[model samples]
Target: MVAITNTTSLTFLKDELDATLSQAESALEVFSEDTSRSGELKVCAEAFHQVRGICQILELPAAALMAEEMELVAEAIGRSVTPERMVGTLGNAIVLLGRYLEYVQLKNAAMPELLVGGINELRRSAGKPLIAESHFFRVDVTRERQPPAAPASTPRTDVTRLCRRMRHMYQVGLLGVLRGESRTSLKLVSRALARIDRLCGDAPMGRLWWVARAAVEALLADEMRLTPARKQLLSQFDRQIKRLVYEGERALESDAPLLLVKESVYLVSLATQDQGLIGEVKRAFSVRPRFTDGALQEELSLMSGAGGSVIRTVATALKEELNDIKSTLDMAAQGAADTDYGDLADTLVRLAGTLVMIGQSREAAQIRGRADQVRQWRNGEVDPEGMDFHALVDDLLMVENAVATLERRFAPADDINREVRNTRISLYQLDEARMTVVGECRAGISLTKRSLTSFIDSQGDRMHLSNVPSVLVGVSGGLMFLELDRARAILEGCRQYIEQSMLTGSGAPVREQMETLADAITSIDYYLESMEEHKPIGDAVLEVAEESLAELGYPVMRAPQPA
Candidate 1:
């Protein structure tokens, strides 16, 4: 749910913000001429409402409040006494709207005192006054809880659909148990818990809250101490939750605690069973198959690295400066230098921080000192001292050139980075693969302890060995390309351990093998994290890993050993 919804919502949100800003600016322009475009003001109000709705759903209070304030100004255009007096105030509101959009995009923007004073003056003229000198950062948070009138955003899937949908999870659970598919059954229960967490998180319902709390704690539990067997049982917590679902049906029906948790996943088996549940409840439980063995993190790391992460850090800092410089450029082209310095102050702080991150503390300190020079200017637009644009403009140009140079320097190379990317993807695929292998290995080991070893396959303890794709060959090249030597070493050892201990026939007791695989994955994950964080990896660590593997009987290492 989170995966699909956030991706789509963010895109939709950016579009709405852009459209709303356009509408507000157009309305302001129309009103600036004669202050008599009541119809245009209404259109702007509708646009503001649209952006406000999407921001509310995203739980971004600051952006939503800015939209609300704009809506109020538009709503007052024709209705207020002396409506002609509010054009300048409305123009300030539109600019503030633009600043808020930038803030939402990268989270470093701040409201200028000019914008604040303008909004407060608008509030006074409209007879809808605000608190004097309200702090922009804290204002929206206090007011976000009060629900506004139904907003003008796109239509959404109703939260009221959860009751009938949750009823469907019960039958899915029963089917999973009947088929002896323990993992499937567990994920089924997990999907239910996700729903409850989304809908009834911290609700007053006693049983429902109890179920939510237990599932959350279990999901967040450390995987180091638990064997695969115990980890498999985490899904069973859903069985105890069945009763709570039934009792809480009334709460779901009444829409007492409304919410949208995540994206809906289709239930394939139920749809095929002629219960016609395929379309009905499939999306009700989108299971992401949480693997505690760090495969998920490895997959995520494919996109993460100092190359990409640091670039984002640099881009975000430079973006504000880019915006301000563009603003100054526009004003200078128009022969209007009397503008505001607040954005310049913010940009300097951001650049200093970015410089510090990139190991240029001296450059950062110089920029921080230069911020005092900038303060003598008006809103960072023009110098108040004899119009000294030459020195300030030169410094700005130097920073711009620095941004361009860093982008070219730190940008990832295609050949090696491709290997890093693919390796991460393959590792994610290996997460479920490893989970299946562990399940099969555990099933086989359980058989030696039982009399009916042959009957296990029919009982849903399926042996999943013959065609399981080996992670070693698939990702080894990529790992090597990334210079994740320690991870590559551990992965090679894991490949050998699987072949020797578990793959020839029906296999052996795999407690040691599963532990080994888990340990190898953990070590590799640490190495991957270190690389992403741009931290130095010690020379001794891979040596220690090799020694550990040799002790475990796998003749493997990422690099050659001494003769």
Candidate 2:
């Protein structure tokens, strides 16, 4: 696995790396302007070479590989290749790398797998064979793996014929997958792999089949996307089947391909489903949940879009321009001779072009049409109260509303934060009830903590903690009202601990037990606070509370699984 540690040396090099990337982009732009300046290509290559060295020094394998591919693209351009065809790839690489660095700095950890798509794009542009998506995915292929049980019925006498039939089954499913019939087709593929696993039981090749089975389960669960690279990986599995059909039963004893096993294990790790074989694989590999493919793509979309700061700036400028246009339209409506409809027409045309550039195609078209009408009006005698003039003013007002909406949509982050901070309790009955319950829960948790603290201080006095059970019961009731089942469950466990352990046990609670109970209470308090603030309540908090409750020997029941 690629480590995400950010060292002092990496931090120190970040600014210089950004400057070098900028220099490379500028040189590429210059070279695009005049191809004869082959020297600019050399400059670009040298910059990328520096970037590769820096990434290598930092032990950023993926980033170093990206820089190497970028250098290759630059050199390819120097060798009389068309710069236009490759500049976009190079430009995207530069921008994406910068954004990724910012992402790492902000998140305090790197997920280099997220950069695979961009890296592959650079490699493709450099005419290099694409790397597997699981290139960074690590797993021990040589580890012992148990295969699925063999069929209880009579064994197949002709192994080659049986294997060939299974291969055919796999091919049919592969066709469905290739044709985009994923959900059903994935089952067929998985079923075929299941048969193969049973056939290869206790053989070295069975591990590959086992992993592939889980990988397909992941795909079927929609944990991963059917990307081009993954499609190729699936195709490679067909060759594995052919090996078994052609080479006889001994082929089952052949060692599984290391890269293939790693990729399959990687897919299993991405799976959200934790049931049966997939769950078994995760436990064996000690895999933890990371970003699913869908979540990763969403993050990439946000990073690639115009930054909030830039959007807010553009929105501000657009509103100012809209105000100017509105003022001119107002003057025209009032029969002001200095209205200068022709000049207004020019301004509207420019505004429309800006709208188009900002991805507001419909708005651009409307503005452009209005501008054309104003151009015609400039040549005619004007009537201040004319329907034509009135309609133009109304349209301008509509456009003003759109500009206002855009401004709000892209409001500055600080302004949004301030607004949230200033938000007052709603007078609506449902919201008021929810907040009231949350407040009650918070106070109850506080009381429970104080009672527990006093009980610990008193060295086993039931009098100090007598009311904790009732207080916890009230909190659990309030949590149920708020529809927070998880928190209520934790509180239920806490109530049990107070009633059964601290109140009735022969001795005072141990220090570890007291701390664990305290931790559970604090987690619920935090949950209630988050609820009142209208912030998202993450599952991690519930997990912490649940784990603490379990440590206290009064574990809450697991939440109900979704149907």
Candidate 3:
């Protein structure tokens, strides 16, 4: 009678399981080039025999039964392994082993539908040319499988301890490679691999091989190698090892591994006669979600980082440019012909237009139309009767000068702060243009209003007003209103700038300046509106005008109107 101690039997069973898995993988590798059905069947027979031995010793009746079925198929193929019959039998054997391993790990007797479907697919491909024109190989099964039930649970704990020890050893070996101790590390890995092979035998050797390959590649990656063939071989080894790691890692997951195993089985069925499994393997792992139009758009929007700050930055710049254009118009209204300033104004407008074009806004199209009009005026295209040519010319010249100054400030590409400085300069030019526009508009508003009032009084309220008076009034009012709108827009823009600056801890000075300008514009708008509505004529107008002048820090008193 053979006496089997619990500890000894458990150790032997664990070792057998490892040996079986390693042998199974090795058999697959060896048979990968065996085009003959008989050769492939023989390979399967050897693999199943190993699995059956492990299962029977471990007392896993279910696994043993599955192995028996696989053995039968292998035997059948061994008799007269025709391409069609051998492919089907081999594919089925792979699927059965994979499923049995998965079931053992998960302890779920009910096979997964995917597993069943995969088996069916392999069976369907039997006796046909490999569907994917690739061969099949197996990975280590026991390294990823659950331990057999033990009364004391000691064996289970030991298995976990051993796996963890191996993982740590592998990690250290990689560190050795990083430190340029390749030969030492390789020796250490070889010893570790040998120990694992001894402990688990041939079954779990695939895992050891993977760990060894990874260690070798890590060392090779840092080496200065001159041989092309050596480099190519190392590269291939690196890719294969990494792929194996990925698959093995995923297989550790109870459900995920089962799915992969099933897919692999199906692939083997279809491509058993082929010499490579690259295409089939890639297709199996390349599953991705199908995106709808809305989903795609949402994804794109997310990619763009579409948000309030981006919108405001663009809007603020645009508003500033429009204000600059208004400032030029104000100068024109005053009969001022500062063409140098005009060029700067035009350039600012163009830059603003460009920013608007890039920003996400429904109003972008309208701004674009206005930009076209500005462009036409700059190019001597249309002379609309009331269009302010002097202002337009001044704006163009000022814009050009501003752009030239920016061009000078921009450093070469190699400059460390070139991009940052360029953005700053562009922003500074924009700020200057904005302030100039606001200042001119503020000064010209009073003058234009006064001139209009004088003309109205000279003609009297009853004097036949031409259609042009309303048009002029409308244009003047429109310009004033537009300037006010721009100011408000700038105020909103400033808020965004301040928030962003606070978050990023940079650009504080620019943000502060914007906030101050925004506050000043708000005050100006309040005073101006009061004057326009409640006091369009005499003392009331004078009172509000004084308040507005004070707000603007202008000490000059209003000229008394003729009674």
Candidate 4:
């Protein structure tokens, strides 16, 4: 037994209890006139009843006895609470109890001065009018005690130990709900059902066991409403739950308890209704799965159904761009500038938009920039000497074809194996095309550079010849130099075109092709350096071009040593 150290502590407790009681009593008076204020009266009455418990715990018999009567009055008023009488009785009870609670708290404080202002405020409220029936107030000198009675039902065999075993499963189900895990929640519900089955036994507290089983089954069915597969799983769980409940009753050898059966049936019906409501809500609001793991496939399927037309339109555009690029390239090769590549450009732009729609922004930006450049160059003014008209057309058409092939290869589809195989084939074909184009460009630049060097050399040699007239030599040499400069400028423009093509197609690994092009250009520069008398000017230009191309993954090749 615990010993009470300080009897003075009880005085403080009594004072606090009185203050709470007083507050309850004051509110009761205000509520008495209006029966519509019964809700307020009920709340005040509950406070008074709570104060009564605290008073009894502190061993203040007088305060505890008064509190017990107040509780009885409060309970009576709460049952048939009318505005006027409930307010007068219940409200008054709450005020008196509130004051009593406060006085007890004040006396318990280490310093009485700490509650000086508080005590005064409580006293002011306690002065308010309350309905006091004199006959109900009886103070008895004698106290009687009675022995505790045994409970009608015995406690079950350590079922709380079973709850401990299933604690993780319960948390998993709860957490799954918070995380929106439809399948995972169902799985947890299934585990909970098994745990409940293991714990069920012959006990007076069997109703709790039946209720828990029914609740878990209901939860399983509810969680499954998110997906068709889970719904089928729920049907299986439902049959099992019903069978389990039936067996438990049969083992009892009595008419199945109405409470267990009624609750089980009610929950099943509620689950069915809730499942229908979930389906309706999903359909009405167009709810889709957001997480990527198992939910991605479901969400993609839903998106395919809802936005099939938009996806088809993008596929059609890609196919058209492929055909247009092929046609344009053939026309360009024949030196025809009349063919409009605008359709290819337009398709590429739309493809970029489609990419963005499907969540591929990085790839989309590359396609968009290439298409925009092609469109702008086609429309804008061109430098007569600097432009390679045919090469420009070829580069644009190649970019269009490459982008279209990429789209066809990676567009989300049901048959991913076939698509992946086709993508690999397309990638191989694109690499071949890139190499062929780079070779043709290098050849064209080399031939033009050689011709320029030959012209310059021939004219310079003639001007130095003693047999030729000075005026004629000057005129021929000047005309030849001008032609040589024009040819060099044209080759330089071809180099720029190759560089830009490499930059645009940088997403593809074409470093080998780029290196080959750079090597060919370096060969042309070496030939020019050996043949031309203006070595300094040619060498400076060659160095800059070499550095730029090298940075673009075109390093200079080393000469082979003797074996």
Residue-level lDDT of model 1, residues 321-376, one tens digit each, is: 65677576467546665555656666777778877887667767767777777667
Better-scoring candidate (lDDT), 2 or 4: 2
Global lDDT of model 4: 0.42
Candidate 4 TM-score to native: 0.24
Q: Each model's TM-score, in the order given?
A: 0.25, 0.52, 0.20, 0.24
Instruction: Give the top-scoring candidate (lDDT).
Output: 2
Leading candidate by TM-score: 2
lDDT of 2 by residue, 1-563 (tens): 24457567777889999999999999989988888888998999999999999888887777888899889888897774466878888988998888877776666666777778888998887778888888776666665564344542324345566567567657756765675555545555776687677667666777788888988888878646688877777898889999888886567768989888888888888777889888877877767787676666666676686345766677678778877987776666666777778888899899888878777788788888988988877533877678877666666655555554555455322111122221122113334566776788789888888888888888878998878888888887877766678778888988888888878888887765676576667666755654464443334455666777876778788777899
Question: Which ten contiguous residues of candidate 1 have the minimum total lDDT?
Answer: 258-267
Ranking by lDDT: 2, 1, 4, 3
C-alpha root-mean-square deviation, each candidate: 22.7, 18.3, 31.2, 34.7
List, in order, the clash count of every candidate structure: 13, 0, 32, 51
- Could you give candidate 4's per-residue lDDT for residues 124-222 as a string of tens digits? 233433221111122221211111112212122333433333343344343444434444344444455444444544433333334435444555555
User: How does each model score on lDDT?
Assistant: 0.46, 0.73, 0.39, 0.42
Between 1 and 4, whose TM-score is larger? 1
When 1 and 3 are scored with lDDT, the better candidate is 1
